[model samples]
Structure formats: structure tokens, C-alpha cells
Target: MNILLTGASGFVGRELVRELQQRADISLALALRSPGRSSGPTTFVVGELAVDTDWLAALARQQAVIHAAARAHIMKDEVADPLAEYRRVNVEGTLNLARQAAAAGVKRFIFISSIKVNGEATVNGKAFGADDKPAPEDAYGLSKLEAERGLIQLAAETGMEVVIIRPPLVYGPGVKGNFASMIKLVEKGLPLPLGAIHNQRSLVGIDNLVDLIICCIDHPAAANQVFLAGDGEDLSTTELLRGVGKAMGKPARLIPVPAGLLQLGATLLGKKAMAQRLLGSLQVDISKTCQLLDWKPPYTVEEGLRRCFGRSN
Candidate 1:
């Protein structure tokens, strides 16, 4: 089987390609605009998939497409109108690729959506599932929701299978974004006040997420299914920090501070968003994905974090 993976240079995409390349039944093809410094069973494409590009024609020969490319959120709002920018790439660009894939008679389209589509803030201590109605709060989440609708429509019209994976905070080797910042802080031995907070957040290891993607590629049960994926265990901020510290061969030093104070300080320091994400609970229930795919995370959170921290052999 021929499989095409976009965003091959990304943290997850790079690992996913390497994971698939080792299998005997699959031929790997990577679609990327800027080639990275790694290699695998991949042939790079030089154009962006979101534009009026003719690159999809060459990829049409593949049996499956893993659409992993998107305009990720930055520290500060880069877009003049964030919603418009997100829609252009996340929604319109995604639809364009899906339509072309359908036209090419591709058997399946695998979309990697975000857990934020469920809600920006946590709903009590309860976790959101796949069947929950999309209540996206941010512009980024709204764009992903819009793209998902397009994928469903395209699948209905083209008779191609669609697998939607909504995963929470994925972390692993070469990780960037907010997760990287936390690791650096721990490495510096900075004291964190999150030890007092007991909120839970779902996270997925890159290896575990890659394994789930492999399952979706061929599993008939995954067809036309919406799945929520994460590590089976939901972890608190302190636990996560400790795990990172352990993986990096350091001890975590936490100081208990009032959550309200933290939020207020973050707001004053222009890190209000960061404060909310860290001090808040955002758990996701991945039971549906497990039941449907019969899959579980093969690596523990500590093990995954250690591998990413690069302090282990």
C-alpha cells in the first residue's frame, strides 16, 4: 500500500514517516514544502499543499493520505485577523487537498484534528469524547472544525473513508511550542508553583500517536469514525513536570502558590494564555478510540517524556 504523509518535517510527521517506513506492507511518500534535515523512505515535494498547486496529482496514486499540515498557533497573534488567516490554511487549504484526494480515487483520508474543537476550557473534571458537539472557542479550533466538516462532505460524495483523530497536547522528541518551554524551565531548575494544583490534562506521546495513525490507515472500524486519542492516564501539571525532570536526570523543585495569583501575574506579564493552559484542567476521554481500534498507549508517560528529554540511553 502506498501512503502519503504531509507535514513530514514537523515533530509528529517526521516520526510518523520513520514509523511507517519500517513496515513491510507500506510504501512511504512525504509531501513537504521546505525539506528538513532528516531522511527516510520519502520523496519530497517542493510546493505547498494549500495553494493552487498541482502536487496532489502525483500523490493521487497513493491509497491513503495523512493530512498533518496546518498553521499552528504562535506566542503572539501574528494574523491581522487571526480567524481569516486560520481559515485560509486550516479550512480552505485542507478542503482543497481533500477534494483533490477524492478526485484521485484515494481510499482513505486521515485528518489530525485538535482536542480544542471540543472546548477551550475544561468542562468540570469531566473529559470530552468524540461524540461531543464541537464547541470550539478559539479561532484556531474553529478553523479545524470547519475543515472537519469539509472532510466529512468530501468522504460522503467520494465514497472515501474518513478518519478524524482529535488528540490533546502531543509531546515527544524535537517538540516545540509550549511543551518545550516547560522542559527548558525544568532543565534550568526554576521553581514551579503547580505542585498544589491537581488538575488533569490529557497528552499523547509521539510514538503512541504514530501507532494510532498506523491503525487508522487499515482498520475498517476507523472508517467514517471520529476518534479521541491520548495517553490512557491523565496527568497533572506537577506530575508532568516531575516526569520531565526525572527523564532529564534532575529533581523537580515545586513551590505551592495560589492559582489566582499565578493567573493575575501571567495576565500582567502578557502570558495570560499560558497561565490558563497550565493551571487549568483539560482532560480528554480516549475510550472511544481505544474501543473502536482496540489500541492502547504502548509507552508510559514517564517513558515517553524521558525519550524526548534525551537523558536516557
Candidate 2:
């Protein structure tokens, strides 16, 4: 199988490149925004993704495409029109690539979406399923939802198989942003006032997500299907901190603070969204993925954390 992978330098794309290269039956090509020295596979400089970006040279002879690039969600966006900016890349650019790939005889296109398309949080222990009605709460989520709809429509019109994988809080080695901050605070032995928060959240390990992406590459059951990706284990904020502590061989110093008081403080500080992420529940149901594709998350949460910290279990 010949494949073209976009965002080859990104966190998820980088891992996908490494895993796909190890397969003897696959020939991989990377579509990068800038020119870079190749590690092994052929690389194509496609420049910035947009509706008008030409992909003819890159899509030549490519059988499948794994698109993982996007503007990404910014917590503190300074752009005047954030939604338009997000749509420019996530929706328009994605549809543009799909259309071009279809014209180039690409058989399959796998899109890496976000769980935010389902909503910001889940209530009453209900997990977000792939078939759920989309309720995007933010600009980034809305853009992804639009992109998914566009891809499905394109697939119907062009006969190209489209697979959408929505993953929540993917974490692994070299992770950045909030996950990295938590690790740093724990490493410094800083006392965190999050011991009392009781909220369930699902996280996907990078290894597990990459494995699922590989499965969707050729699985007949994956054609035109939306799948949710996770580690199949839900963890509370306190439990997650403890797990991270266990993995790092350093017990977390947590202070038992009331969840209500924390929320109040966050509201006062105008950090309600951040607080919800730490205090609210967001779970994904990946049972459909397993049943349809006979797939399982190969790495357990504990094993994944150990790997994240460079420790062997």
C-alpha cells in the first residue's frame, strides 16, 4: 500500500510515520509544510494547507491519505475571527485535500478528529459515542464537525472511503500543554489542590491511537465509519494524578480541597473553561470500534504511563 501522510512532523503524525515505516507491506510519503531531510520515506513539501493549495505532485500514485494537520485549538486565541481561521484550515483545507485525493484515485482518507465534536463534557456517566449527534461547543470543535460532514459528503459523491477517528486528550512521550504541566508540577513535588475533584475522563495513548489508525487503513468495516479512540479506561482527576505519580515513582502531594470551592475560585479568576476540563467528565465509548474491527487498545493505561515516563513496568 502506498500512503501519503500530512502533518508528518506533528505529535500524532510523527508516531504514525514511525509505526507505518516498520510495516514491510507499506510505502509511505510525508507531506510537510516545509522542506526537511528525510529519515526514510519520500517527503513532499506541499506548503501551507488551504483551499487553493495544489496537492497534485504530492498525491501522485498515493493510495491512501492520513490527514492529521489542523490549526489546533487555542485556549487563548488572539485572532479577530477565530472560527473563520479554524474553518480556513480544518474545514476548507481538509475538504480541499479530500477532493484532490479523490481525483488522484486515492482509495481511503483517514481524518484525525477531536472528541470535542461530541461536546465539551458528558453528564450522568453517559459516554460520547461515534453515532451521537454532534454538539460542538467551541470554534475548533465546530470546525472539525463541519470538516467531518464535508468529508462524508465528498465520500458519497466521489466513492472514496473516509474514516474519521475522534480521540480525546491523547498523551504519551513528548506530550506538551496541560499534560506536560501536570507532569512538571508532580515532578517538582508541588502540592496540588485537586485531590477532591471527582470527574471521569477518557484519554488515548499515542501508541493506541496510532494502532487504531493503522487498523482503519485497510479494514473494510472502517469505510465511511466514524470511530472514537481511547485507552478503554476512564480515570478521575485524583486517580490520574496518583497514576502519574506511581508511574514516575514519586507520590503526588495533593491537598483535599472541596470541588465547589475550586470551581468558585476558578470562576472568580475567569478560568471556568479550564476548571471544567479538570472537574467535569468527558468520556468516550470505543466499544463500537472494538466490535466492528476486532481491535483493542494494545497498551493498558498503566503501561502507557510507564512508557510516557520512560520507565518499564
Candidate 3:
């Protein structure tokens, strides 16, 4: 099978490429902005991501496509209209690729979406399910939701299988942003106020996410399905930090602070949304993925952390 994978240089895409190379039956055609940067037994097509970008070279003779590239969510707005920028790449670019793939006779398209499509946080201990109506809370989430809808409609019209996988807080080696910041803080033994946060959150390991994407490539049951991917275990912010500490062979120093006070301080500092992510509950129920595909995460949170931090032999 020839698979066209976009975003070959991204955090997830790099790891996914390593995983894909292990499969002897699959050949890769990487879609990158700079084809000269990648040297492998894979085909590299140079194309920008936008409404008018060409995808014929990437889609030709490919059996499936794993669309992993997108405009990532930003914490601060430097752009005049962030939604339009997000729509330009995530929605319009995605649909353009999907339509071209369908025209090229690609059988399956795997969309890597985010849990934000189900909303930022869970309500009253209820986990977000695949069947839940989308309630995207931000520009990035809304764009992803729009892309999913377009892909499903395209699938219906063209007989191409579309598989949507929504993952929450993916972590692994080379992780950046908030997850990396937290790890750095934990390694430094800095005092954190999140010990008082009692909210639960679901996180997926990159290996597990890559595994699920491979499963969706050829599974008949994955056609036109929306699935949530996670480690099947949820943890509180305090527990997550402690786990990080353990993986780093360090002790966590946690200072008890009320979640309300934390939120108030974040609001004053213009970090209320970031505070909510740390203190809020965002659980995902991945039962449908398991029941339909007979799949389970191959790595636990601890093992994933150990491997990521180089604590495992």
C-alpha cells in the first residue's frame, strides 16, 4: 500500500514516519514544504498548504492518505483574524486535499483531529464520547470540526472511506509547548500550585496514536467513523506532574492552592485559558474505538513517560 502522509517534519509526523517504515507492506509518499530536506525511500512532493495548493503528485497512485498537517492552536493572537487563517489552512486546505484525493481514486483518508471538537472540558464527570455533538470552543477546534464535516460529506458523495481520530494532549519524546514546560518545571523541582487541582484529563501517547492511524488505514469498520484516541487512563494535574517527576527520577514539590484562586490569578495575568487547561477536566471515553476495532493502547502512561524521558532501557 502506498500512503501519502502530510506534515512529515512535525512532531507527530516524524514519529509516524518512523513507525510506518517498520511496516514492510507499506510505502510512504511524504508531502513536505521542502522535499530536499527529506531523503528516504519515500516520495516527497513540494507543496504549500492553502486553498489553492496542488496535491496531484502526492495523491497519485496512493491508496490512503493520513492528513496530519494543520495550523496549530496559538495561545496568544498575533494575527488580526486568527479564525480566517485557521480556516485557510485547516478547513479549506484540508477539503481541497480530500477532494483531490477522491478524484485520484484514493480509498481511505485518515484525518487527525483534536478533542477540542467535543469541547474544551467534560461536564460533571462525564467523558466525551465519539457520538457527542461537536461543541468546538475555539478557532482551531471550529476549523477542525468544519473539516470533519466536509470530509464526511465528501466520503458520502465519492465512496471514499474517511476516518476521523480525535486525540487529547498527545505526549511523547520531543513534545513541546505546555507538556514540555511542565516537564521542565518538574525536572527543576519548582513548586506548583496544581496539587489542589482535582480535575481529570485524558492524554494519548504518540506511539498509540500512530498505531491507531495505521489500524484505520485498511480497516473496513473504520470507514466514515469518528474515533477518540487515548491511553484509557485519566489523571489529575497533580498526578500527571508526579508521574513526570517519577519518570525524571526527581521528587515533585507541590504547593496546595485553591483552583479558584489559580484561575483568578491566571485571569489577572492574561493566562486564564492556560489555567483552565491545567485545572479543568477533559476526559475521553475511547470504548467505541476498542469495541469496533479490537484495539487497545500498547503503552501505559508511565511506560510512555519512561520511554519519552529516556528512563527506560
Candidate 4:
């Protein structure tokens, strides 16, 4: 199979490139945004992702496309028109590529979406399912939802198989942003006040997400289906901190603070959004993915944390 992967230098895309290269039956090509991003005969620089970006050379003889590029969600976006900016890259650029890929005879197009498309948080332990009605709250989530709708409609019209995978917080060795910040704080032995918070959140390891992407590449059951990706284990904030400490061989120093008081303080400090992420529940149901594809996450949350900290045990 000849596969073309976009966003080859990104966090998940880098891992995908490494895994795909190890497969003997796959010939991989990277559709990078600029030259010299990667050094290989198969690397094609297609410039910025937009409606008019040229992808003719990269799409030639490519059987499938794994598109992972987008203007990611920003917590404090300074742009005047954040929604328009997000749509420029996430919706318009994505649909443009899908239309061209369908015309180029690509059989399958796998899109990496986010769990935010379902909503910000699930209430009362009800996990977000794959078939739930979309309720995107932010500009980024709305853009992704638009892109998904366009892809599904294009698949119906063009006969190209489209698979959408929505993954929640992906954490691995090269993880950045909030996950990386948490690891750093834990490494420094800072006492955190999240011990009393019992919010359950779902997380997917990079390996697990990449495995699902590979499964969707050729699985007949995956055609035009939306799959939620996760590690199949949900963790509370306190449990997650302890798990990280255990993986790093350090005991977490946690102070048992009332969740209500914490939320009050966050609201006073104008950090309510950040507090919600730490004190709220956002879980995903991956049972459909397992039943349809007969796939289980190869790594458990504990094993994934161990790998993240470079521990073999």
C-alpha cells in the first residue's frame, strides 16, 4: 500500500511515520508543509494547508491519506477572528484535500479529529459515544465538526472511503502543552491541590492512536465510520497524578482540598476554564471501536505512563 501522511513533523504524525516505516508491506510518503522538514526521497513539500495548496505530486499513486494537520486549539487565542482562522485551515483546507484525494483515486482518507467535537465535557459519568450529536463549543471544535460533515458528504458523492477518529488528550514520550506541564510539576515534587477532585478523563497513548489509524487504513468495517480512540481505561485526576508518580518512582505530594473551594478560587482568579479541565469529567466510550474492528489497546495506561517516563518496568 502506498500511503501519504500529512503533518509528518507533528507530535502524533512523527510517531506514525516511525511505525509506518517499520511495516514491510507499506510504502510511505510524507506531505510536509515546507522543504527540509524531513530528509527522504518520499518527502513532498506542499506548502501551507489551504484551499489552493498544490498536492498533485504527492497524491500520485497514493492509496490512502492520513491527514493530521490543523490549526490546533489555543487556550488564549489573540487573533481578531479566531473562528475564521480556524475554518481557513481546519475546514476549508481539509475539504480541499479530501476533494482532490477523491479525484486522485485514493481509496481511504483517515482524518484525526478531536473529542471536543462532541462537547467540552460529559455529565454524570455518561461517556461520549461515537454516534452522539455534535455540539462543538469552541471555534476549533466547530471547524473540526464542519470538516467531518464535509468529508462524509464528499465520501457519499465521490465513493472514497472516509474514516474519522476522534481522540481525547493524547499523551506519550514527546507530549507537550498541559500534559508536559503536569509531568514537569510532578518531577519538581510540587504539592498539588487536586487530591480531592474525582473527575474522570480519558486519555489515549500515541501508540494506541497510531495503531487505530493503521487499522482504519484498510479495514472494510472502518469505511465511512467514526471511531473514538482511547486507552480503554478512565482515570480520575488524583488517580492520574499517583499513576504518574508511580511510573516515575516518586511519591506524589498531594493536598486534599475541597473541589468546591478550588473552583471558587479559580473563578475568582479568572481561571475557570483551566479549573474545569482539572475538576470536570470528560470520558469517551470506545466499545464501538473494539466491537467493530476487534481491536483492543495494546498498551494499558500504566504501561503507557512507564514508557512516557522511559521506564522499562
Candidate 5:
């Protein structure tokens, strides 16, 4: 089937492109924001994401679209109005693309969303699920939630299929941001203060997320569905650090700092929210996704981490 994919150069997009390239049955039309060179069976279309960005040509004859491009979440945003900025690109741009794609008779639209839409963290033993009401705390999460609503509305009005996948902390080879920083600290054998953090968090590897995206592209049961994607296992902060350390051939070297003291230090340093991310639980339940498509994450947490760290176990 012929498909149109956006954000072909991003972390997840890069892996998706590599995986899609190996599939002889699929043809890809990559919509990029910059002037990118096209090659092989993939065609690159240069266009930015905005209300006025032209996507008619890209949508033409495409059976499905995997929309991955968006104004990504920033840990320390410098924008004056972050919500407005996110709305302009994520909500407005996404809806613009969907409206045009629907007009062009695109069969399905797959949206890559975040677990933040369900809230920043989970309490007690409860985990975020597909049926939970959205409670986006930050601008980026709010924008994605709005975009999901718009896509569902478009699907209802225009008869186009819409599939939403919310993944929690995707990590793998070439992963950046906090994950990469953690890997570096582990590689250097630096002492970390995460030993007391017993909070559980769910993380999906890039390979597993790509596999689910491929499934949603053509699965009949995926139409108009919201699914959570994970590695099928949750881990504590200490466990995650230890795994990373082991993968990098180093010691965990974690100091047993009290969680309350850590929180207070973060508050004094104006990084309280960031500390919560490291110390609090944010688990996602992928049972609905598995049961719907008869799917399971093909890689275990350890295997995925080993692959991500470029090590063999």
C-alpha cells in the first residue's frame, strides 16, 4: 500500500523510515519540513506544518498517513506563549492536514500522541488506560489532546479512519533528551541519587513502537481507536539506572538519597517538575492494544535496552 509519512528525520521517524524501507509491499511518500534528498522507493516532499502548508500533492493516492511531526515538548521552553505556539503547529497544522487528507480520500490517519494526555503521573496501583479522560498538564500534551479530538471529529464527519497511539517514554538507539543523559551518566559511572525512587514507569522501545504503528496502518480493528503502547513491562528508577549501567558495562553507583530531600532540592533549583518525572510513577496499560490487534511487544525491556545501548547480552 502507498502511505504518506511525516517527520521522516526525527528519532522515531528515522527508525520508522529504516523499517519501512525494508518492506517491499509498502511505498512511502515522506513529507519533510526542510529540503531533504529523496532516494530509492521513498519520495521526499518539502513543506512545513501550518494551516497554509500545502499537503494536497502528498495526500494524493495515499492509502494512509502516519502523522508524527509536531512541535515537540520542551523541558525548558523559552517561548512567550507556549500553549499558543503548540496550538499553531500541533493542533492547527494537524487538523489542516487531516481535513485535506480526508478531502483527498485518504483511508486512514494514524496519530502519534503521548501518555501525558492522561496526566503527568499515576497514583497508587492505578495505571493510565485507553479509556481515561485526558488531563494534559503541559502545553505540548494539551495540544496533542486537542489534535486527537480534531482528528476523531474529522473521522466522524468525513468517514476517514483515525487511529491514535499514546506511547510512554520511547527509548532506543539514537535516543536523546533525558534518556541519553542517563546513559551518559551511567557510561561515566557517575553517582546518581535515584536509589530511593521506587516509582514504576512504562517505557516503549522504538522497535516496538514502530511495530505497533505498522499494525495500526492496516488493521481493520484499529479504526477510530485510541491505544496505549508500552514495552509490556514497568520498571523502577533504580532498576532502570541499573539496567542502563549493566548495558554500558559500568556500575550503577546509585546513592540512597531520600525521595523527599530530592524533591526539596529540585524545588529549590526550580526543577521540581523534572524531579517528579524521575521519582513518580507514570505507567501505561497496553492490554487494550494487545487484545485489539492480538499484538505484543516483540522485544523485552532488557533486550530493547541492550539494543539501544549498542551492546549484546
Candidate 6:
């Protein structure tokens, strides 16, 4: 398979290349905003996703294109205006690229979307599925939802196949974002008050996410489908912290703080958003994906966590 992948240097994309390159039959061509790096079997192209002009030839030749580029969430920069920037790249940029891929007769266009599109806070014990209504809270998620809408509309008008995979929180080697921060906290022996928090959240390992993406690329039913994927197990903040502690060879010192008070303090300290993410539930149901594709995750949550734990501190 000749595949065009974006965000090659990003967390998921980097591991994705490593996993996909093992197959002698797969050829990878990476599209980046700047071609400043190279690794494994990937060849780079320097161009931003915001433009409608280039990448046509490359898109025409590749059998599949996995769109993984997007503006990620930031904690302190909540009030900042990133809509224009996100729309330029995540929305308009995605549509432009998809249109080119469709015109080029590409077999499939797989979009890596965030589970944030389904919700801002956790759905408690409830699991989010592919058919749930979109309720994007922040600008980043809203932009992603817009991009998803545009892709569906485009697919309807064209014969191109569209597959959307919404993952809760993906963590693994070279992982940044909240997962990395948690690892840092655990490594430093910080006193965490999450032991009392029993919220269930689902997360995807970089390897597991890549495996699902590969399945979607070749699965016939994945066409014009929206799937929510995870590690197939939901763990609470306390449980996750314990796992991280175990992986780091240290037990997490969880405090018995009230969830309400934690939320209050976070709000007072201008960290309400952060508190919600850590204390709330963000579970996803991968049953549809599993049943439809007849696929099983190659690694369990413990194995995935161990992979990141070994890489961190």
C-alpha cells in the first residue's frame, strides 16, 4: 500500500510510521508543513495543510491518506483566539486535502479525530459511541467537528471513502500533553489527591491506535463510517495513577480530597478545565469498531502503559 501520512513528527504519527514500515508492501510518503526531519521508510514533503494548491500529484498517486494534523488543546491558553488558525489548518486545510485526494481516486481518507468532539467533560459511567451527537466544548474540538462535517459532505458528493476515528487520549513513546505531565508528576513523587476519584476514562495507546487505523484503511465497512476507539478498557484517574506508579516502581500517594472541593480549588486557581479532564470521565465504546472490523487490540492497557513507563523517566 502506498500511503500519504501527515503529522509524521507528532506523537501518534511517529509511532505509526514505525509500525506501518515493518510491512514490506507499505510505502510511506509524509506530508509536513516543513520537511526538516526524516526517519525509517518515510519520504517528506514540505507544505502546510492550509493551502489548496499543492499535494495534488502526491495525493493522486497514493492509495490512502491519513489526515492527522490539527491544533491540539492548551490549558493556559484557553482565552486565546485560535479559531482562525485551527480553521485554516484543521477545517479548510483538511477539506482542501480531502478534495484533492478524492479527485486523485484515492482508495480511502482516514481522519484522526479527537474524542473531545463528543464532549468536553466525561460521560460518567456511560460510554460514547459513533452515533452520539457532537457536543464540542472548546474551540479546538469545535474546529475538529467542523472538519468532520466538511469531510462527510465531501464524501457524499464524491465517491471517495471517509473513515473517522475518534480516540479519547492517546499516549505512548514521545507523548506530550496531559499524559506526559502525569508521568512527570508521578516521577517526581508528587502528592496526588486523585486516589478518591473514581471517574472512568478511556485512553488509546499509540500502537493500538495505529493498529486500528490500519484496519480501517483496508476494511470495506469503514467507508463513510465514524468509529470511536480506545484500549477497550476504562480506568479511573486513581487506577491510572496507580498503574503509572507501578510502572515507575513507586506507589502513588493519593489523598482523600473531596471531588467538589477539588473542582472548586481548580476553578479558583484558573485550572477548572484541567481539573475536569483529570477528574471527569472520557470513556469511548469501541464495540462497533471491533465487531465491524473483527479486530482485537494487539496490546492490553497494562502493556501499553508499560511501554510509556519504560520510556519516561
Clashes of 6: 1
TM-score of each: 0.94, 0.99, 0.97, 0.99, 0.98, 0.94
TM-score of 4: 0.99
Number of backbone-clashing residue pairs for each candidate, in the order shown: 0, 0, 0, 0, 0, 1
Q: What RMSD, rounded to one decimal, does every model reach? A: 1.9, 0.7, 1.2, 0.9, 1.0, 2.2
Best by lDDT: 2
Q: What is the model-wide C-alpha lDDT for candidate 1?
A: 0.85
Model 4 is weakest, by summed lDDT over 10 consecutive residues, at 32-41
**For residues 17-128, what per-residue lDDT tens digits would candidate 5 score against the true structure?**
8899889999888897877665654565657799988887788899999999999989889989999999999999999999999999999999999998999999996999
User: Mind giving the per-residue lDDT tens digits that candidate 4 earns over 1-313?
Assistant: 9999998889999999999999999999999887875455399889999999988999999999999998998989999999999999999999999999999999999999999999999998999999999999999999999999999999999999999999999999989999999888888999999888888999999989999999999999999999999999999999999999999998788899999999999999999999988999999999999999999999999999998989997
Q: For model 5, what is the C-alpha lDDT against the true structure?
A: 0.91
lDDT (C-alpha, whole model) for all candidates: 0.85, 0.96, 0.91, 0.94, 0.91, 0.84
Tens-place lDDT digits, model 6, residues 16-129: 778887877788888877757645655657477775647765675799999887766665565457777778789988899898888898979999998988986656477888
Off by over 4 Å in 3: none
- Model 2 ranges with Cα > 4 A deviation: none
Q: Candidate 6, which ten residues in sequence have the lowest lDDT sum?
A: 37-46
lDDT tens digits by residue: candidate 2, 67-180: 999998898999999999999999999999999999999999999999999999999999999999999999999999999999999999999999999999999999998999
Clashing pairs in 4: none
lDDT of 3 by residue, 1-313 (tens): 9999998788889998899988899998888877565467576665778888888877889999999999988888699999999999999999999999999999999999999999999868999999999999999999999999999999999999999999999999999989999989998888988788899999999989998999999988999999999999999999999999888889789998999999999999999788888998999999999999999999999999898888873
lDDT of 2 at 223: 100
